[model samples]
Target: MSVKPGAADTSAAVTTASWLPLIVVVLTQIQASFAVNALTVSMAGITTDLDTPATSVGTAITAGTFAMAAFILLGAKIGARYGTRLVFQIAVAIHGLAMAAVALSQSPAMLFVAQAASGAVIALIAPALTVFIATNFSGDQQAKAIGYLAAAIPAAGVLALLIAGSFATTIGWRYSFALVVALAVVNLVLSFRVKPVPPQKDITIDWAGAAIAAVAVILLSFGFSGLNSWGVILATDAAPFSVIGVSPAAILIVLGTICAQGFFQWTRSRKAQNKPQLFNLDVLKTGAERATTICMATMMFVGTAANFLIPLYMQIIQGRSSLQTSFSIIPYTLSIFIASTVVARLYKTYSPRLIARAGFVVVAAGLILLAFTIRGDWHQIFVVIGLITLGLGQGAIVALVFNTLLTAAPKELAGDVGAWRGLVHNMSGSVGIAVASVFAVGILGTLVSSQLIDNPTIPASLKVESGINLDQVNFVPNDQLVVTLENTSATQAQIDEAIRINTEARLRALRTSLLVLAGLSLLAIIPAGRMPNEVPALEEPQPTKGKK
Candidate 1:
């Protein structure tokens, strides 16, 4: 039986009342999506205000992502037992309160705690929304509905960044959290329309699996998050004011791996005893399922890394205002929407594999172009390359991952698979941002050490005003400090001169990261080639006996 009670009836028409519920679900989903953007925007603000290191701020994001992934199965169980409508209400409420607290937080610890609560709430809401859609609509309607609904995430991201930049500039970053509270209010009011599903009687909740998964995800995410820290980047040489410690990240990674293996064993043991397991091992053994999961993770890792790094480069290095940087990325945001809409149409006529491959090729070609053409004289070339390639890749990624994952999974296991898909996508995004930040930091440090320019004296007032330690400023290394100085109230002549030198090094770092992404993208080509010309897995729903 499908998880949702009435979702598999393809021949039935949606009632007028049904539309309101669907709209409510979409609105609720947008709150979590808004968090994705809010977190990214606030990364800089938190680091600046709390006197926390940039890498530490970055880690908090990864921690939240880890929490979200680890708790998704638990969220699914909550939905199955307590029902979707109630679970969504609780999720929405918890998330809103957390956002409010985050806005008030004065320290990194407080921010991390707030993020953890928000992550838990996100896990509860995301998968339940998917199940609600699946159980409500079936057949082609289901596919089309999900495609449009899924687009809300990126759309919310764009909206959040736009609002955050403007509000932060005028009223301060705290006011940006007020935006989420307002959205939550709308979501709460609209949630009245979400019709309740009857709770399942035989549903099994796997507390053991949930605990293990949480530990594993937190450990793994923490490890990856540490990649952005100085401890890992410069292990041997102690630079000025650099963080010194054993590899806390590495230890967490090892612990996470162990937890994962243990969790798998526990699930298998439950199945062996003829008890219900949280996940169906049999469903995951298929090649298509495995391939689809891998592809989703890879795509998210690359795409998210690019998104995080590009904004940092523009706002921090290029001395663009946050608003200007947001506008610069407007090309990326619009390209995703435009290409996704067009590709949805094209997928009906052409093999998705072929279309997806074309997108990958365009992305690789564009990145390669940027690598070679990045110079002061050729800045426009980089913009053009980013626009064309990023558009193609974003469109292709959404269609390929969403469709393929859904098509490959068994109909009965759709909710479980959807939960896993969301988990993978978010986890990869977290890691991608972490890994990319690490490389960026390392590159900046190297640039600083080369001593190609006259190093400016560390501003005493600036450190005091920002409430950060002088040692933290010293740890910035040469290259990044130059870029930071260029963006500040420095003389225009000095800023221009710093820009010339900093641009060259920044281009080098950006190109190297893009090359790595290009290589990861090539892995998708083979998997895409193997996809069936037609999606045979998705058949018309069998008619219910009474209806016929």
Candidate 2:
């Protein structure tokens, strides 16, 4: 029997259809990239148009991030019960509406609410995407496709910043969100093309588990974001308990953990004999998988921190235009795309662990170089870090973790494991952004405070030169640091000096943060080593598979 081209050939159909699932997954991730960076790129215009305080605007971002972390697993459950295709449609609609609402927000409350809604969509869609791909694809296709999905996010982010920044500058920041609505529509159309996979028959969403997880993530995110806010954490010296009780960090660590543990116990109690449980305890039981997951999150966190800081520094300190700011981030997008799409494939032959470990070493060395060599002549350091160091680390992490996690998971529970992995990665991204914001605020404030004390003779000029209006500066830094700096009133010499100082501070902070990431990256080596050295021989799913 001669095989007809693109007709009645199972292998060809599978190959063509394989790409469709990946496309769907990539589309889902794109929504999040826009959500995270749209606000960042549009911050300047949004703040001005809405007449909201900068800190309030910053808090809106925090709210969105918290909402995502809280709701991601819930999304996965939805995908499991219904099919991923159905869930994707609903998510796209919600996310699109949220974006539209964000564009029309009249108050900070409206903005925060809209952002949170969008974040929830982001949280759910990401895991659903991973689960969908895991269930649909097999063997090397799974690893390579996951890498593409992983790479698509950062690439989308870079494009979003560029487009948003350009549009926000020319038209308005509110208008920039129109892109999301458009993207959502395109993604919605794309979703129709994705074939439905078998659905989980016995899906049970643990509401208590979901609730506890949400509360815990919100509290933890808040706590991490408020790291610089000692007063918020400590309250008054006389009433420290009040501060402690309200502190997100404290609640997440102490109360959140209790809730999470209770949820786990509840899941165990509810699980039937030989039935798979939500949040598989077995996955965590594997030391290598556990470490790999943690490392996955940390890698995303550190990369996000760099992405967050570089833009703010460029805009706030360098006074670049939005278009210029976005352009500067091009290297990151290019590098990550190349590594994810190209380098990831080589993992089949080379040890993924070695590739990932080398990535961290390069990243650490790059960060150190950036920290030590930041001066007036060292403006190109951002590109080096983004293109080479950060890009390599991110690429390898995607390739390594996706490959390792897939290998470790049994065929029946692949979707769940993939969802869990996506959860760790996305939540870590939020945590990273929040943590970076905290550090950025502290860095700006401390620098300004010191400058004021040192140059009391020229305090007014110093204030302007340092780019520190404590209230406004506390707002999250985006890719527009250059623009923010240009808006300041420092003379050339003073501007140069300020850039010099801030650059050093940022570089040093980046070094410290990346070192933490390097340590985390090394942790994955053990787990990757434990992964099966070769792919198992391909076999079709048995007719009596437990999933359906």
Candidate 3:
């Protein structure tokens, strides 16, 4: 009754041939994982070269995330029908070509188009990679493979930072995207070990459900993406349109929620009619799975926020290079890789809920520490200690939650699990980055306005004539702020006052953002507690006696 089509799930982990396919699947995952992190580190260079605001680059990133979250279910259908290996092969080729086009794009709009194209193809690559592993490995081997797959994310991110940093410094940021071309080549060559699963010809694809979900995800993502730019509550001048003076961002969010509910209702209706459903609702039927999903989303929310804010602060605000950002993150990234790999050993002893709660607690403590420590000093010993602590927690929770979700489902539902994983994780990451920007900028604007109004040294006339618009403030180095003030008819005294205020304001924004992120981390402990007290024990596969 399990929905595996065409290909047979391997027996006893295939001690010989399964190794190759496992490696291939992990490579496919790493290739897809490289996309966003590379873009994140290169954001400043892109914004500068394209002559656009910071929000423009942020929107492009969010648009790609939206495309991936919206189309991921349809991608699952494609993978299930056309087969994992072929879908992966073709998807990676398209993804690489699109990224190369992204490198060539001379404007923000063109970059958005290219990244969106790549996100659509990545949706296919996401689910197919999971399915490939399930079909080729089982038991102990499957468990080990899943750990590698989980670790591949941070591993890819680390590599992306290094490569993007190098390219960003010397050849130009455009050349950084060329790295994906290399990934595509390796993925294509190694993907042969993964067998194709036959399409379920009888299962009718649910186009209506897909449309509803797409509308829900895009609206929600776009709405969140503009929270800072378009205003959080009331409409700002950036509002494209508003209803009754309310922010379009809030309105779109409400509409998106309604559409999301509609998706669930329609899926239920399909099930009642005994028609095919787009996603396997059965995967979410258990309490453990639902809790795991919540924990996963929350982790990504904080994790992605950190990823975005750190690079924004280092490269844009501090005038550091992308290479500096990479080295700064090495402690965190390496800890993630190491912890994720090691936590699999502890699952049999410590309960899932226990380990997960511990991770969140550590993350919350670390964030709180950063809130107190970050005062224009990212490389301080205390700051590095906090980051390492957070990384250890992040690494463990991800591995624990991901493995829990995988084991909670039957092998036949691997594609469903993978698709759902992509949707929640990427969607949560987009939301995280958006929320971070919103809080940091919104707080900065308020703090800056109050401080400016109260300052004794800067006259109101001089402040007004400075041509500095806090409402549309972009992250720039203090030096750039001085350069930007060239248009102003302000005196040297007023300019020094402006620089001092902006500098203090920047640190305030960074610290407050960390406070909010810490709050979110503490709140996640609820779901972490809801995860299964312990994972069910499956018999570990015995090694074939004659196998090497």
Candidate 4:
């Protein structure tokens, strides 16, 4: 039943294809996307239910993405050794079980573990989706299928927001994950109808490289995530451990960077020795491919940061309900879905470099608009416009960069391309959320402390007596702040002043964070310029180069 390496299944040709397989692929994608997005929309409920901070949900998100980035290259090889269909089906089943664990999670620890498990399973599913398309379809049909798969990410977000938001509001956040469990069962059933890809039995798994990659990513994720809690430059009270008075976050980041370099060096040595590589370096042999990766990572970082910031502001800062937060961000998610679906039309007319550069400009403009216009209201016309504009740029770039990479590489390396894509996407997303939280929270803490010190209305004696650690301030709703202050010796007037200071400080912090992200969006344009000036024609793959 095994086909020759890189050979397509002619039975599933474009003219003869039923499109049912694409549906299965897209639905499988939605299953994972919904799990992540459901967690995002349910952030408020999760914090209350688990008696944890909002940052705990962000940590869970970081854990999931970090696990995926760490293991995806290995997952791609696993899919190649085993049959893609069999591995994908098993991953989907395991992912379903993970989602059920998330639904039943009683603590933040349980939630983080469940999410990380789901992410590891997605590493298998992500590459399989690409391999399925490469093996089953040819020509424009393959292009069309890839577009649908990309669009499904944002489409899943919209669905999760509505469904999960409703469930979180009406019943509880747990029901949202229960719904994903159902979707997983459905996806698993439909997967049987998809075209099968035979295993490449000769493919070897690089265990050493996998171990290096996993350790590197784990360190980087924890480093970035702990920057605030563990102190940016020195160990804080919250840090579990430190190295020579320096923050463990800083130490971990340095070690991670070194390990990442070592991984590449080890892979290069493996390539020279004619041994199997954990990832196919040939996929990135060209500058255009490398640039495409940078562009992809930048877009994901900015987009994820913005997405996280908006919801954090709405739910945690403004005290909006989960359903209300979902409704507010609908325009953004809907725009992403629409843009991802239709961006392929431009591939024929414009070069990727042109489209990608223009997309960055649009994204920068949107972020800048958001920074200046946001206020007490989340329903403003300008805010909605900004969200739509940002989403449009994000969607177009995500789809375009992915398509460009796939077209540029030979068909045999499709899984590698997909693995690299998933790695960059998830790694950047994890860092994005981590950095955004740190920046926003850090700024808020600084502003609150400064204001608390200088304010003449609040007596210094009362501040000292309040016992609130200004250095460790966190974002809390005004009512909660008031209750805490009321329990202390502070009078009503002092509580009112504290509330005013917190409100203004939170707004200022968010504005500052958005502006910084907009600057990053502008910087990404440099890499976009290095993308392919012309569309890459999908040529028949060259023969396998002797199997490494």
The lDDT per prediction is 0.67, 0.65, 0.80, 0.87
lDDT top scorer: 4
For every model in order, what is the number of clashing pairs?
3, 16, 0, 0
In model 4, the runs with Cα more than 4 Å from the true position are 1-17, 39-63, 100-116, 168-178, 449-454, 468-470, 487-497, 540-548
495 Cα displacement, candidate 4 (Å): 4.7
What would the per-residue lDDT of candidate 4 be over residues 1-548, giving only the tens digit for each residue?
Answer: 22232343364322445688888889999999989989998998999999999999988987788888889999999999898899999999999999999999999999999999998999999999988877766555666788889899988888987788789889999999998899999989989988778898999899999999989988987888788789888899889998888999999999999999999999999999999989999988999889999999999999999998998889877799767777888889888888888887776667889899999999999998998888888878999899999999998899889988887877778899889989888779878887888889889999998998868888788877777788788788888888878878887788888999999999899999999998998998999999988767654333345643
lDDT of 2 by residue, 400-509 (tens): 66766765666555556666776676667667776777655665566545654566343566576645665433533333444555676646665565555556555445
In candidate 1, which residue ranges exceed 4 Å CA deviation? 1-22, 39-63, 102-112, 171-175, 230-246, 377-382, 439-503, 536-548
At residue 439, candidate 2 shows an lDDT of: 59
Against the true structure, what is each candidate's TM-score?
0.79, 0.77, 0.87, 0.88
What's the lDDT for residue 82 in model 4? 93
Q: 361-446 in candidate 3: lDDT tens per residue?
A: 99888888877887665768988888888888888888778777777777667888889988988779878988898878778888
* Model 1 lDDT per residue over 1-548, tens place: 22122223344543322456567666766677777667767666768888999777656665676678888877877777777777878888888888888788898898888888888888888877777666666555555556566667767768877877666666777777777877787887777666666676587788878888778887787667665552454432332233354556656667888998998899999999988777667546767556656666777887788787676656555666566677777767766666654555554455556766677777667556655655433258566566557756766667566766665565556557667777788778878888887776566546634534334533344334434332222222235655666555566565455456456566667767777777777767777665445543345545555653
* Best first by TM-score, ranked: 4, 3, 1, 2
Q: In TM-score terms, which candidate is top?
A: 4
Candidate 2: where are CA atoms >4 Å away?
1-18, 231-248, 269-277, 312-324, 381-387, 411-415, 433-548
Q: Is candidate 1 or 3 superior in lDDT?
A: 3
